[model samples]
Target: MTLGIDVVRAAPKVLLHDHLDGGLRPQTIAELAAGIGHELPVADPAGLGGWFAEAADSGSLERYLETFEHTVAVMQSAEALTRVARECVEDLAADGVVYAEIRYAPEQHVSAGLTLDEVVAAVQQGFDEASASGGIVVRQLLTAMRHQARSREIAELAVAWRDRGVAGFDIAGAEAGNPPTRHLDAFEYLQRENAHFTIHAGEAFGLPSIWQALQWCGADRLGHGVRIVDDITVHPDGTAELGRLAAYVRDKRIPLEMCPASNVQTGAADSIAEHPIGLLTRLGFRVTVNTDNRLMSNTSMSKEMHALCEAFDYGLADLRWFTINAMKSAFLPFDQRLALINDVIKPGYDKF
Candidate 1:
């Protein structure tokens, strides 16, 4: 049975990859920008929202990333960070996201005289406040910009705050020249400390990026590993073959955090229907759906699931599988993950 959008929206979801800075409410951006005297391409909230979607749809990873200038500009202070983070939780909860890991680079928010620790504290404050009354549980994943040299510093920060609320660490940026191995020291630190991290690979780049992220950097999960499809070849008689690397990924159950809408906007895929997720899911790979950037992609977890149902003819069982896959792949403790799967996710989906 084809689930309607409303039904999909009501299904409990788990988001493994979402950008805190990229999911700001349009109205909040307008108010905050005006308060700080930051100039935006469009002053009105509606126009600004449309502008971001259009600007980020440039079909180039670098150009797509450039849309963050305005959002990041308005988020320099503690008040702004707290407010944005709180609203992010509220919004995700309303969208039926029972669990999520929101990521952002602390280095980018420190230009306002705040230290890296202070930046994390402010964002955590927001998450805590919203989670107090909660239907949702939210955690932070501190990200280090791949082009920067502060990854080791950020890794330490994540470990320092792991008990406070920070769940893990990550590195994300242009995937062309800045390979994941550049941050080998940071990943090594995380591994030694028994921390978890996901590397942004196989998105704009190809198999080499994925190979380095897993083989050299030792990432726990792959961020946007859509390009793993390149390693798989299909025959006309409907058989498929997986190359060595692809076979390894599937064999080990490495989760691919696939963002369909964002991938299409960034030219990683032509359209949602043509996305590699369909092929990957069919091949029995551990695939989880996500909204990499809500404002930039104009998407939510519900919208992403609904789109997939339309594209792949998925039903509630399929949606349940994706949510379970995400919860299993989360950086949360094994016991906690099991509880959410048995107590929350599976039961919630059974209601449908």
Candidate 2:
């Protein structure tokens, strides 16, 4: 039987595409804004959370991104970064996320007196302190703004800190005109160094964007690869046809970091009921659920799973499948991934 939302909430989860600045607690944001003498559209924490969700609900992708300006405004200092990072782990632990890879661009945080290295150090310290509570493994993905010209620097930063706590590199920001091919040099550098990287593609764009990321830049995973559904056509007789690109993605077993709610808000999908994650997951295309922006979407891992359960009739067993898929696709070493599966994820789900 499909259990209730309570069981879904209690299930151990893995998060792969959450953003650090976008996941801050509303109260933390308010406090940080005040401490920095910055202004917010809403001052009260509860009101501010609602405001973020409402603002992000705008149907335009460009308009949806504007909500980040406030969150990024308060995160320019080391103290603010550490506090947000620590609270991020604590909140994820409370929400039953046993493992997560939180990504943030270091370039966005250097406007204050801190250097790029100082920013990473502060966030790492926060994750370390929060992990002391146990039952949570948090890693970092140093992201570069794709619309900017610093991807090579960010990729090098990821490689330099691979032995420390940084797990991999990623390219984020708008995807309209800034195609992944623009950063081919950075991707090629990571390839030569044998480093891992995922590119944000096929979200606001279409299949050509995804092809460039995978075929041109060699991405390990597709961030918000929701638009790949464009290549799939469902017939009236309930049969489906897969385009060459979709077939290649499935045959290659490429992971799609699908964020359902965020897709709806950003106009990638019509709604959760009609979201492509259901089709992709059922088709065995290496689907993984994620919360792209917890604060903006007002979501958690449990919330995302519960929504999918209601949307797709997913049960405990089905939820376990998604959890394990995310774990397998994680950038963590094989030993670490298997240990988490054996000791944490499987046991946690088996109990339910």
TM-score of each: 0.99, 0.98
- C-alpha RMSD values across all candidates: 0.9, 1.1
- The C-alpha lDDT values of all candidates are 0.95, 0.91
| lDDT of model 1, residue 225 | 99
Show how many residue pairs clash in every candidate, following the order shown: 0, 0
Please tell me which predicted candidate would have the highest lDDT against the true structure. 1
Candidate 2 segments whose C-alpha is farther than 4 A from its true place: none
Q: Highest TM-score among the candidates is held by which one?
A: 1
Per-residue lDDT tens digits for candidate 2, residues 239-275, read 7899999999999989999999888888888889899
Candidate 1 runs further than 4 Å off? 60-63
Model 2 pairs in collision: none
Error of 1 at 180 (Å): 0.8
